[model samples]
Target: MPDNGDLRGVESTPRRDAQVRVFAMPPSDNATPTQIVQGFLEALTSDDPQYKTARMYLTPRAAENWQPERSTTVLADGPDAAARAPVQDDDEHVAFTLTGREVATVDAQQAFSPSSGEYNKLLRLIRDAETRQWRIDIVPQGVVMGQSDFERNYMSVNKFYFASNTAGATRNEPPMAVADPVYVRSHVDPTTQMVRSLLAGPTTWLDPVVRSSFPTGTALAKGAGSLTPDDRGRLVVPLNGKAAEVGTGRCEEMAAQLLFTVRSPTPAVEEVELRSGDKELCSLAQESAEAVATRGSLHSPEYLYFLDEDQRAVRIAAGSDDTEPEPVPGALGEGEKQLRSVAVAWDEHTAAGVAVDGKSLYVGSLVSGGSLGEPVLRSTGKTEADRLTAPSWDARGGLWVADRNPAAPRLLLLEEGAGEPMEVRTPGLDGRIQSVRVAADGVRIALVVEKGDRRSLLIGRIERSRPDGGTAERSPVTVLELRSAAPELEQVTAMSWTGDSRLVVVGREKGGVEQMRYVEVDGSTPDIQQPAALTGVKAVTASPDDKVPLVAYSVDGIVRLPSASQWQKITKGTAPVYPG
Candidate 1:
C-alpha cells in the first residue's frame, strides 16, 4: 500500500483539440459606445490571458476592477442580438443589453453548473468629453460568451488524483487513477496550462473525494513560470521552496501524478521530474506510473450484460474472441417477469431491474439458483411514463432510479435491501428526468432530462451536507450545480459513463442522424476513435475503463465497438449494461 493519496482519473485522449479562433474585429481608432461594447463582448471569446485588448474598450477604472475569472455566463444563442437602448436624459450615456436563455455558468473558481432563465448582459457606456471616445462605464466583472464560441474557444483537461487505499480491500482493488475535468484555453500550450491547473489543486466538485500527492501550497519551483518537456520528451517541473519539505518517497508519488496528468496522445511526455530550484528531488517514467495508474477507471468489465429478445438477462464477452451469449444465473435469467431495463452491481453479485410495465423495480442475486425476488419498489404514478426508466447502482450498494411520471417526477435512491427510498432534490431543473446514472465516486449524477420537445444530458453534483448536530442523514440529499453535459446533442436518448470523467452517448445533432459518440462530463467531446455505425440505438453501455469494448442495443441487434472505426454484432439483446 502506498501512502500517497486518493486516486483520480484521466482519459488517454482529450475530447477536442481544435485551435480556438476568436473573430474579434480590432477596435477602430475612434469607437462609439455600441461598437466598444460589441468589441469587448467579442474579445471575451478569445484566448487572451489578460484581456489587454478588451480593456481598451473600458474606462481605466472599469478595466482595473474587471475580473474575467469572476464568472462565465453562457448564452443560448449568438451575441448578434444585442440591443442598444433608446437615448436617455444624458446623450453622453448609453446602454446595451444582450438577452438570451442562460444555459450554464462557471463561478470565479471555475466550477461549472447548468442555469436557465432570461440572461441579460447590461453595459452602461459614457462618452469621454476630452478624448472623444466612448468607454464602458458600468458592467459586470466576468465575460459572456455564446454557446458556439464556448465550444470552439475552450477545451476540457483532466487533472489526475489517486484513490484512497482502504483497509481490508481485495487483491484486485489496488489504488487507481481518477480524472477531474477542467476547461482551459484551447489555443494555449496545453502542456503548460494543464500542469499549472494541476498545481492549483482539484476543483470544488472533486475536492472531497480525491486527494493530491503534492504538499499543501506546493507550486512550480521559484523562477519557473511555465512547464515544458526537454529535448528527450521528459517534462521537468520545478517546484517552489515548499517542495523542499517532501521526502524521497513522497516526492516520487508526486512525480507519478505529474507524469500521468501531463502525458497525452499529443505532446506524448515520456517521463516527469520533480525539482526544487536546480536540484532534482524525484523522477518517474511513464511506464512506472502506469503500474499504479488507472488512466481513467479502475474496473474493466469483460462481459456486456443485457436482456435478450425473450426479456431474459444474459451475458456476452465484449471481444470477438468470445463465444455465444450465455444466460445469467439469477431469476432475471429465468425470465419469470418482463423487464424494461437492468443494472448489475459493482461486485456482480446482484442485479436491479425495472419491470416491462415500467412500474415496479426488482432486485435479485446473480449467483446460480438465485431467485428474482419481489419488486423492491413500485411507482405510485397514474401512467406508464411515470414508470422507472432504468436502475443504476453505486459503489456503496445504493440503487438509483427516476420516476418520469408527470404528476410526481423524481430521482430516488434505494439501499441494497428493502431500505426506505429517499427522494433527491433537484433545484432549477426545468424538465423531467428521463434516466439517471451515478458515477463510481458517488459524488456526480448523470441525468437525461426531457423538457418539452428537447431531451438534454445534464450532470448534477450530489450534495450530502450534515445537519446542525453533525449526525449522518439517511434521505437522498440535494443536487447542486446542475449543468449541461452534452449541450450540442439535439436529443440524448441514452448514455453510460465510459470513464471517470467520460460518457458514451447516443444522440443526434440538430438536423442530423442519431449516432454514438464520447463526451466529457463537462459537455466537451473528446477525440475518440469513432465507433462503428450504430442505428436505432435503444441503449448503450461501456465499462468505465477505455480499453473495454463499448456495447450497444440497436435496431438490428446487439453490437459492440471492437475498434474505433467499426461496430460488429454479437447477439440479439436490448438494454445492455455492465456491473456499475
Candidate 2:
C-alpha cells in the first residue's frame, strides 16, 4: 500500500473507566443565589475533590463505551493553576459567581500560557456544577458537551435526562438529540471525477445511485424490487416485465428505485433467421421488428440500414416518434448493393453509403469478406482502385471515399453532377481514414485515422478556391492519442459532439469494457469517464440538443439517460442486438 501520511491524533485527553460522583443544587429564591453558588465552590475545594483533576476525565466518551487510555502528559501543577496565574490579579480569583456568591472556582495550572489550562478548568467547573446534588437527589447520570452557544442554552434548561436512553445515542452522553434517518446514494467514476448520479432516497429514486468510497465509474442499479448479486458476481435487479441489465463493476447495496417505461409488443410480425460468426442467436422478424434511429430524418433515418428477412431495406428514424408505421422498401435491385455503413453531411443535405461485394480486407490469417457486387457511392477516378473502404460526406454536398487497396489510401471528392470524382490530398494525414465528422459550421472536417491499432484525430479546413477546385488544409487540432502505455483502446465505436464543441468518444478498453470519454477541441486534457460495464456496444447517438445520449448495447436492450441524473428504460420485450 502507498504511504498517505501519518494519522492525526485527537487534541483532547483520552477517556477513562473510573466513575466519580459530583453534586449541585437547583437555584431557588428563598436560598440566596450566592448561597447556592457558594455550595459549588466549597465542593471543589473540599479535602478531596469528588472528580479527578486530570484532563482525560473531561474528554468525551467513545461510542463503543470504551474509554481511551489516560495521557501521561498531564500538567505538573494541574490544568487550573497552569492556566491563569499570568493574567490573574493578586486579589482576583478565576471563578464563577452565582448571583453574588462564587459557586465554582477555576485556577490556571500554567501561569505563562493560560489558555489551554483555563479551558480545562472551565470544563471541570461546568461538569461539577451540573452533577452536584440537587435538593432532590438527581443522580449524575450523564455528561454532555457541546459548542459554546449550545452549552449556554442547554445549561438554561430546568430538567435533564439520561443521554444513554436516547434512541440514537451511540454513547452514554450524546451531544445532541436524535435525528431522523436518511439514505444517501452517489455514483462516481474514479478515473474521471464525473458524478454519474447522486440522489437522496425517497425523493430521487429515479436518479443513478453510486456508493460513496467505492472506486469511481462503478456501475450501480436500484429498482422497486430487491437487488442481489448473481452467481457470476454481477448485481441483478429483476423488474416486473423482464430482467434489466446493469453495468458491471463494484456493486453497492442501497435503497432506491430507478423509474423505467414498460411497453406492450407491436402487432407486426415476420420471422427471419440470421447468423453471426456461425452462431445462431435469435430469429429476426422483418415486418414486426422496428428500427428507431436517433438524430436521423425521413430521407436518411437509418444510421444502420439493414436488410430484413423479407430482403427489405429498413430505415429507423432517430428520436421519439408516435407516427403510424409503413412497410419498409424491398432490398435494392440485383445491380444495386446493400449499404454496410453510411455517413451524412453536417448540413444533412448529402450522404454517402458504402457496400462491399465479393472482396475481403486482410487481417493476419483471418479472411473477412462482405457481400459481393454491393452498390457503393461512385468514387473519383483518381486511382484505378476497385473498392472503397469508408465513405463520408463533405461540407459542400460532396462525397469523399477512401480507397484502401493501395498502400497509400487516396481521398476522392465527388460533386453532385460529376462524371469523374476529383482526388484531393491533405497534408499531415498519412494514416488510413477510419471515420469522419463535419464540424458544426460545415467549413471544417474532423477525421479519425488509424495506423495498425493506434489511432489519431485530425481536423482539416475545407478550401474551395484551391487550384483543384477543392482543398483540405490540415489543422493543428489533434484530438486523441490512442497509443498510450496505460491501456490500448480498441475500435472507435461512436463519436458525438456536445453543445460546447467537446468531442465524445466511445470505445472498448483493453479489458473489453465499454468506455466513454470527452476531449475539448479548445485544447485541454482529455477526461475519460467510464460508464456502466457493457458487453458489446453497437450504436451510440446523442440527442439533437445534446442533452441526452441514447446508447444501444448488444443483448442488454436500449439504455436512455436523459441527463446524468435520469436513467430510463426505453425499450421492452426485445433483447439487445449485436452486429457481426
Candidate 3:
C-alpha cells in the first residue's frame, strides 16, 4: 500500500469494531471549494494517524491552528456541507456551513461524555493564486464525524487503577482494580497511547474515586519510538527520571498498571519491563500480575443459587444442565425463612436475603451447620410495597440496601455486614430509591430512583471522607454527583454491573416492548449492542467475572443464556443470582 519512494503506509493497530480498513487520500489537483471541504471531512474518518492527509486541504495557517487531538465530536449523522455560498467582491472566496445533530464528545483525555444539541459551524475557503487550488482558510479545532465513523475510527479500553477508598481490599475479597474506560484511535499505536494515558492519570469524572500508582511528573522516556513486543513476547517501556524515583513496590504497581491497560490490544505480550534510561526499574510477568490488582484474577462461580418452588433457597452447578437443584447448606437455604429476593457475597461464603414481606434483611453463612443472624437492617414501612428493596454487598465486606419508606426513605450501609447501619448521604437524589447494585470496585453504586410514576437508573460516585482525621475504617461515606446512566429508558425495571464500566439493563421505552440492553456508566452513548429479548423478565444478574452465563427469572422460570446460545429453562426457580 505504498509507492516506490521513501513514502509508505503508516503502521496500524488492529481494528476492534470493524473488519475493513479505510484510508484517506490527499486532495486532488485544482479541487473545487466544496470538494476540498468534503475531502477533508472524509480524511477525518480514515486511518491517518496524525491526520496529515486531512490537513493538506487546509491553508498553511489553518493547518497549524487545527488540533485534531483536542477532542472528537460525534454526531447522529455525518455533517452536511454541500451547500456553498460564494462571497461577493472577493471572487476567490466561498463559505460552507456544516450542520449535524450532536450525540457525544470524546475529550482530549479520551473520556466519552454524552451530549445533545444542534451542531453548526461555517468554514471559509480561498483559492491560492500560486497553486490556483482551493483550500480551507478556517477549520474547526477538533474532528467531527457521525456515530458510525466514530465506532469505526476508535475503540474502547479500560485503564486500570486502584480503588482509593476501599481500605481493606484484598485479591479475592474487595476488587482493587477500578476500570477507567477511554476511547483511543483504533489504527494508531494504541498500546503506547494507553501507557501515556495511564501516566496522565484518570479522567476528570473518575479521578475522585481512584488513584494511579505512577507518581507525579512520571512519563515515558524522551524518545522511545513505537514500542512493540519482541520475539520473546516482552514489551519494554522506558520512562522518565521522575518515574524512576519510585521504590520497588510502587515500581511493580506501575508495571501492573501498564500491563493491564494494554492487555486488550497486546494479549500476546507475556511480560512488561519498565526502564529508566538503561536501568531496569522493575519487571512483571502477566502470570503473576494479579498480586497488584485482583479484578478478573479469579474463576467464575461454580454454582448458581435461587429460590425453589417451595420458596426455599437452592443451588445448581453452573457448568452442567443435568444436575438437580438442591437446597443450599445455609439458614436461608434451610427453609427457615421465606425470601422474596436475595444477594450473595463475592466469595460465595455468605449471602443476604430479604423476607417475603421485604421488611427484614438477614445475613447467613453458606457453610453447613452455619446459622442465620438476626435482621442486620429492617424497614418500618406500613406495607410490603413500601418496604426495603433487595440488598447489595460491596467488594469490601460492606452490605448496602435502600428502604423505600415514604416517610423516611434511606440508603443504609453496614461495615463488614454487621454493626450499626450507617446512613449514606445521597445529595443529588430527589426521588425514593427502589433498587441498589454496588459495583465490585466499590467506587460506584447504581440506584433505581422512583418519582411519581417514573423509575430512572442513576449511577453515583461513592466518596469517603475523614472529617476528624479518623482511621481507614472510620471514613465517612457519601454518594453524590449522581448522573443518569439510562436516560432514554422510560422505566429501568432491573439492571446489574455485568462488567467494569458496563451494565446489563432491562428497560422499556414509551409504550414499547421491554428490551434488554447494555449501557455504560457515562450515560452518553446509546446501547446499540444488546442481548436477546426475554419476556416477563422480573430480574437479571451477571457474575463479576463477566464470562459466565446470564441468569434471570422470567416467564420461563429460571433461565440461563450461555455465550452464543439460546436461553434455556434450567429449573423452576425464582430470584436467581450468581455470587456478586
Candidate 4:
C-alpha cells in the first residue's frame, strides 16, 4: 500500500491502450472554465476514488448533487467540450455545449447495453463570488467518456446465476450456472463492486430467465464495504440476516455464486466465506463451486470432435499432444452416413449430424453400436446450399439450426434432439437465414444473415413464450432483438461461442483481409488480445472451457491454436467442434 490513502487501495494496472500510468490531475490553481470542464471529463475517465479530482472543479452545490456512480455514457470518440458563447443575461456566467455521438451506456446496476443516438448536454459555468474563478454550477448526472477510455478504465466480468429451476425439490438434476456479464472499474475494489452487483440482482435483460440464489432484499452486512482477499486468498463476505436463514445446501449455492462473481478480482481469491451478522454461514472453495451446478457445463480436458476427409466423425484430445485424430464411437463415426458437419451434445452421449448434401439432420447416440436414426429433419430446399446450416445444441437439450431455403427461410428448434420440430420465430430478422449457433446458456443465439453480397453477424435473444396449453403449432419460441455483433465486418464466414458472453468470429472487413477476433455479446469489442489471424477460415469452434484450445476448419485442413502458442495442424479434418 502507498502512503497516499487514495493510491493505497488501488492496484497499479497500466491503462489498456497506453504503456504508462494515467492518473487524474486536480484542478489547476487558476484554471479557466474550459480547462475545468476538460480536466473534469478526463478525471471521470481516470480510476480516481469516487472522482474526487473531478468534483473539485464543480461548484460545492454541484459537487454535492453529482452522482458519478449512477451510470456511464460512452461515446464514439469523446465529448466535445467546446466553449460556447457567454451568457448574455449574466456577465459572470458562461455556457458550454458538450456534444458527442452516444454508443452505449452502463446503468447503475453495472449492466452494459448498446445504444446509439445524438447526444447534446448543456453545462453552465458560474464565476465563484469568493475565488473569482470559474466553477461548473450545473452538470449532468453520471459520468461520460469515449469508448476507448471506457475500455481502458472498465473491464467486463460475469455474475453467475442459476436457471429458473422451478423443479426445486426433486434433486433429479441441478440447475445450470448462467453467466451475466457486466462492466466494472478495472481496479476500484472490483471484488466488492462485483459482489454489490450480484446482490443487486441480475440485469434487466437476463432477469426473466435467470434466478439468483440470494434471498429477497439480501445485501452485504451493514458497513461491510470494500471487501478484499487476505494474504491467504480467503474472502469473507458478511451478508444481511436474510442470508443466514437458508440451509446448508442453499448457503453453499450462494457461496458458489460469490466465488464465481468475485473470481475476476486480482490477487486471486481461493475461497469465499459467507457470514451473516457476525456468524459465519458457510465457506466454499473456488474449485468446488462448479460441481454444485455446472457438471454438464462443457467441462474442460474434453476431446475435440470433427469430420475427417472421409466425412466420418473423429476427435483428438483437446490441449494434448499433436497425435492423429481417432474415430468417435457412434453410428455417425462408423456408419457411412456421409456427413457435412456435426454437433456433439454437451453430455457427449448423443450427437446431431448434417448430411453431406446438407438437406437432412440426423441424430444418434455416441456409444459403440450406436445406430443413426432416421433423419430427424429434412430441408426441402432445391439445392444443397439452400439447405440446413450446422447443427447447434444448447445445455437444456435444445437443438438449433437454420433452414436457408430462400423461398421459406426458418429457424428450427428440436426439443431434446427428438420429436416434432418447433419453428422458432425470427421477429427482427432481416434477409434469409445463413447460419445459427445457440449459446450454452440457451438464452442467446448467434446468426449470420445474408441479405445480399454482405453477410452480417447478428445476436438474438431467445424468448420462450409457451402460452398456457400452447401446442407445437403456436409460436412458442422466438429469437428477438436481433442486433449486429460485428457491424465492422463486411462478410462473416463462420463463428462459434467462445465463452458465456464472448464469441470467436471469422470474417473479413470491407475490402480487408480475412481475420479472426473476439466480440462481446453486447456488441462491444473487448480489450484482450485476439487470436492471430488465420487464412481461409470456413468454420470455427471454441470451448466453453477456456483451457481447451481453439480449433478451426480452414482451407489448409483442421488446425488448433493453444493458449499463447502458434497454430499447429491437428489433422486434416473439417468442422472441428467441442461439446456444445
Deviation of model 2 at 217, angstroms: 48
Q: Give the TM-score (vs. native) of candidate 3.
A: 0.91
Evaluation by lDDT, superior candidate among 2 and 4: 4
| lDDT tens digits by residue: candidate 3, 113-216 | 77789999888888898887889988888999999999878888888888886664433433378888899987788888888899999998889988888889
Q: What are the lDDT figures for the candidates, one per model?
A: 0.76, 0.31, 0.85, 0.84
- Sort by lDDT, best first: 3, 4, 1, 2
**Residues 1-580, candidate 4, lDDT per residue (tens digit)?**
4466453364686654543346799888767777888988999988786888889889999999999999999999989987687445345888898999999999988878778888889898888888887889889999999988988788899888876732322555656777888999985778888898899999887787778889999999999978989998899999988888898888888888888788865537999999998788999997787666662234673688899888999888878876598888988889559999999888788889999999999998888887886899999999999999999998777788889998888999998899889888888788887888887777778899999899999988787765647554543787787888888889999998876678999999998989999998877787777997788889889887766778898888998898887877777888988887
Q: By TM-score, highest first, what's the ranking?
A: 3, 4, 1, 2
Write the residue-wise lDDT of candidate 2 on 1-580 in tens digits.
6489888775898665463323333243333223333443333222221223211122233212322111111122322222222322222222331111111111111001101222232211222244431121111122211222111211110000111111122432211110111111111111011111221111111011111222233332223232322343222222221112222211111111110000001112123221123333233232222221111111222332223333223323443331222222322312134444444444332333454331321111011232223233344334433456444443234555566544546565655413355666566566776655544323345566667776555445444432333454421222222212112345566554443234555666555766655543322223234344445555444422343344443444444444453334444211111110
lDDT, residue 496, model 3: 86
Best by TM-score: 3
Regions more than 4 Å wrong, model 2: 1-313, 321-336, 344-351, 356-387, 417-419, 468-493, 498-500, 508-512, 522-533, 551-562, 565-580
1 versus 2: better lDDT goes to: 1
Q: Which digits, one per residue and each the tens of the lDDT, describe model 1 over residues 353-465?
A: 88888989989888788776678888877777777879898765788898888888888888664577888788988899998998766667899999888899988877665
Top candidate, metric lDDT: 3
Candidate 4 differs from the real structure by a C-alpha RMSD in angstroms, to one decimal, of 5.8
